[model samples]
Target: MTLDLDPLRSGLHHRHDRVLIAAVAGGDTAHRTYGAPEAADAEIGSVSKGLTGLLYQDAVDRGEVTPETTLGEALDRPEGAYAQATLGSLATHASGLPPQPPYGGPRTMLRRTWRMWRHGENPYGDSVDQLLDEAADVRLGKPRFVYSNLGFALLGAALARTAGTSYERLLLARVAEPLGMTGVSVPSTPRCLGPTALTGRSKGGRPHEPWTGEAIGPAGGVRATAADLAALLGGLIERRAPGISALDPAADAPGASRIGAAWLTTRTGDASVTWHNGRTGGFASWVGVDRDAGVGLALVSATAASLDRDGFAGLARLRAEADRC
Candidate 1:
């Protein structure tokens, strides 16, 4: 059975400046575009973390590192809260790290938001070194299923250090290049300034810069097209990616879902849906796979508002429809 994505297409156009939706089922692929051409790139936000998880697992497969490898050992840093955290813990969001660094207080966040909306400033300006410095004093709490961007940033950094390369290079070599996801990349500058990049907007309707820089790249910095995302998801579903173990359940998350190296899985009827959603200052993205149905889907929008609710609802419905086929 073919999937009808018209409702998703309409909703995306109404809520975003540009949108891309793609789906793959039984080896047949299809897509819909609105307000943007298929090649236009949009930030994938935290969805990048899911890719980072793939990279980490690839490293594990090569024996470059192990899931039990501690962050301190991988990064060669002195022992501390973050150092004691294992790679598996970080990937599963059980490292006890906070959602963000402590330096950005409420006032700072407000100022950054204003600058982003008014001047199109890239709010994540800290360099990797600077991020490490900020993370030095972070007091980790007890390990649990707490989502932490800082933890992911550290995980990406550790993975890169283990391979003696940069995160972007590692990802490109191990994941993007292998999967034929040519449009997936970490932009060195504000993507909003690029000709093929879509203009992003704040939820309040103010134009904002597309996310850039390496500070948040691992946690949420990927810019990609719908085709690239569909290819990546398809690779995961087909077991073509090297780190297929990343999709295996690692820990429990909220709502009875299982977390597996940044991918979250929840039962939808007799099938399981593994998915991740992302949002940045000017973009939102969602990617999911219904393994039982042999289907994958990706949605990207040029908007800052969270698309988690709509994305989950749509993907669940799509999965149900695919099952009926």
Candidate 2:
């Protein structure tokens, strides 16, 4: 069956800044853009967690770790909440970890917000050591589907430590390089950003800080173009990416969706759409695939206007449109 691209194209044009939409079917690929077409780098927020989940699965397959391996065994931190949490639980957001670190209190959040608006400060400046220190007092809650950025952060750290490298390098070597995703990266500093990197803005029209740094890279520090993200999604759909099974649904989630390692899965007729979305202070992103339809899509926008909701809606519409084709 043929694939329809008009719905996605129109969707991108209507409600986003510096938008990019990409889709792939079989060996054919297409891209559409609006506003800053040249802006290829935008923060991908928590979608980074999905990629991190893939990396964790790869590590497990290679025997570098195991699903049963506890965070304490992996990170060598035998005390506190993370100690008893397993790698599988962390990747699936079933680790009973909170959403953020204890140090991210109200006062710290306010300061971070101020810095974001005033100085474009990188809110995630704390090093991995600092993150672990801050997490020392954290108490694990009942194990269920609680999305935890801190859980992903610690998972990435443990994986990196197991490989004796950083998360950025690990992602580059294992995922990006393998998939030819040259545009996917974690910028070390603001100065390292590309010329076309998007400037993230706040809801109040003020420019906010770009989310970067090592501590948060695993949770939400990726930057990539629509083309790159489309390729990644296609790779997963075609089973060209290692550990692609990580995208398979493992448990039930909110909104009648199923939770995979880090992806959300929903059904549209006979097609299963597995997706993950991202949002930073200034950018939003969504990537998904309908393997049965041989279609995969990626969307990125420079505006931070809660694109997650819009993205899901758009994808559902796009899926319906594709069905008609």
Best by lDDT: 1
How does each model score on TM-score? 0.91, 0.90
Q: Which residue pairs collide in model 2, if any? A: none
Clash pairs for candidate 1: none
TM-score of 1: 0.91
Worst 10 residues of 1 by lDDT: 101-110
Q: What is the lDDT of residue 160 in candidate 1?
A: 91
Candidate 2 per-residue lDDT over residues 43-128, each given as its tens digit:
88888988998899899889999989988888899975678999999988888998877776653755876776676566676788
Number of clashes found in candidate 2 = 0
For candidate 1, give the lDDT.
0.81
The candidate 2 region of ten consecutive residues with least summed lDDT is 8-17
Query: What TM-score does prediction 2 earn?
Result: 0.90
lDDT string, candidate 1, 201-240, tens digits: 8777767776777768889988888778778878888988
Best of the candidates, TM-score: 1
